[model samples]
Target: MEAIFALAVGIMAGAGIYLILRPRTFQVIIGLSLLAYAVNLFIFAMGRLRHGAPPVIDPRLGSDPALYTDPLPQALVLTAIVIGFATTALFLVVLLASRGLNGTDHVDGREPEDE
Candidate 1:
């Protein structure tokens, strides 16, 4: 499971980087989102992977610290998700306005010449 999760993160980060280098503004936005997702996954993974474990400690259970999952990473990831969403929305609004004013969605503000 860990290997699969790591592979997924690597793929997402790689794709995000590739898309970010593209000429289209929309693609860049999507790339940013993908990168954010990859980072969130990485941060979440830092909390350790455990099955059937509660996020919070149960008083009834002895405080061996292994009975519960780390909640810090979860909380951090949740916060990052909210912030990433807002950032993406803002980027979209800017993209639309730029497209409207320039009549193009290219990052360079002009369409590529036909070769």
Candidate 2:
């Protein structure tokens, strides 16, 4: 499972980087989103991957650290998700406005020349 998770993160990061290098603005947005997702996953993974673990210490349980999962990473990821959504929305708005004003969705606000 750890291997799979690592592979997934790696793939996402790679794809994000590839898309970020593209000339299209939409692709760049998507790339940024993917990169954000990858980072979130990486951050979340830092909290240790434990199945069936409670996020907080139970009063009945003697406050052993191993009994509960680290909640910090979870909270950080949650906040990041919210921020990412807002930023994505803002990016979309800017993209639309730029498109309307410049009549192009390319990063440079102009159509690409044919090679």
Candidate 3:
């Protein structure tokens, strides 16, 4: 499971970097979203991967770190997911507006001519 998660994170980060380096505006937005997901996974992994562990500590368990998974990473990841979504939407809107004004999907204003 750990290996799988690590592989997923690596794949996402690699793909995100590749897409981010592309010339198209839409690809950059998608890359940003993928990067955000990779980051979220990295942060979540920092809290340690524990199966069947509750994030919230039970009162009866009496504040033992070993008994419960840390909730901080989970909370932060959740918040980041929401922020990433909003930023993706904003990026898409900006991309559309730029495309409309400049008449091209490329990052630069120049449109590629027909071959």
Candidate 4:
């Protein structure tokens, strides 16, 4: 499971980096999203893998930490996901607006500004 998580993170980072280098606004946005996903996954993976248990303690069974996965990583991942959605939405809006206003979606500007 750990190896799988590591592989996922690596793939995300690699793709993100590749996309980020592209000279297009949309690609940059995708790269950022991928990077965010990788970070979220990495954080979630830090909690370790567990199955068939809830983080909440079962009073009837007594407190045994091993029975549950750490909840902190789960909470962090949830928060990250929400933030990521908002960020992606904002980026998409910006991309659309830029295209509407300038007729181009490249960061280097459709027409070079006079210096």
Candidate 5:
């Protein structure tokens, strides 16, 4: 399971970096989303993976460590997911506006002028 998560994180980072380097606004947006996903996953993974563990503590159990997942990572990831969504929305709106204003979605706008 750890290996699987590691693989996922690696793939997300690799794809995000590759897409971000593209000379198009859409690709950049995608890359940002991908990177955000990778980051969120990485943060959540710090809580440690467990099977069939409820995150909330049960007072009846007299403080059993194995009964609950780490709440800190869950909280952090939730906040990050919300922020990431807002960022992605903002980027999309900006991409649209820029395209409308300049009539192109490419990062550099017009092609280079040849001498």
Candidate 6:
């Protein structure tokens, strides 16, 4: 499972980089989203991927590391997801407004034929 998560992170990062280099506003937005997801996954993975583990330590168990899961990474990932979503929506709206004003979706405010 760890290997799978690592592979997924790598794939997302690579695709995000590729998309970010493209010359389109929409691709750049999607690339940013992918990069945000990769970061979220990395942050979550940092807290460990233990299965069937409880979030809090049991007092009677006397601090058994193997029986508990870290809650910090989960909380951080949750916050990141919400922020990423809002930023993505904002970017989309701004992109739409820019397109309407300039009649182009290119980052430099010029049509492909003009370049």
Compute each candidate's TM-score over C-alphas.
0.92, 0.92, 0.91, 0.86, 0.90, 0.87
Could you say which candidate leads in lDDT? 1
- Best-to-worst order by TM-score is 2, 1, 3, 5, 6, 4
Clashes of 2: 0
Task: Evaluate residue 1 in candidate 6 and report its C-alpha lDDT on the 0 to 100 scale.
Answer: 96
* Segments of candidate 3 deviating more than 4 angstroms: 60-62, 112-115
Q: State model 6's lDDT.
A: 0.90
Residue lDDT tens for model 1, 1-115: 8999999999999999999999999999999999999999999999998788888888888787878999999999999999999999999999999999999999988898995
Q: Where does candidate 1 have its weakest 10-residue lDDT segment?
A: 57-66
Q: Which scores better on TM-score, 1 or 5? A: 1
- Please, what are the lDDT tens digits per residue for candidate 4 over residues 1-115? 6788899999999999999998799999999999999999988878887766686788876788877779999998999999999989998998899988889888765855674
**Better-scoring candidate (lDDT), 5 or 6:** 6
Report RMSD for candidate 4.
3.1
Q: Rank the candidates by lDDT, best first.
A: 1, 2, 3, 6, 5, 4
lDDT of 2 at 86: 98
Write down the RMSD of all candidates, one decimal each. 1.4, 1.3, 1.8, 3.1, 2.0, 2.2
Clashing residue pairs found in predicted model 3 = none
Error of 2 at 52 (Å): 1.4
**What lDDT tens digits, residue by residue, belong to model 3 across residues 1-115?**
8999999999999999999999899899999989999999999999999998899978987887889998999999999999989989998999999999999999986676774
Candidates 4 and 6 compared by lDDT, better number: 6
TM-score: model 4 vs. ground truth: 0.86
In angstroms, give how far residue 47 of model 1 lies from its true place: 1.3
lDDT of 6 by residue, 1-115 (tens): 9999999999999999999999889999999999999999999899989888877777887787767899889988999999999989999999999899999889878877754
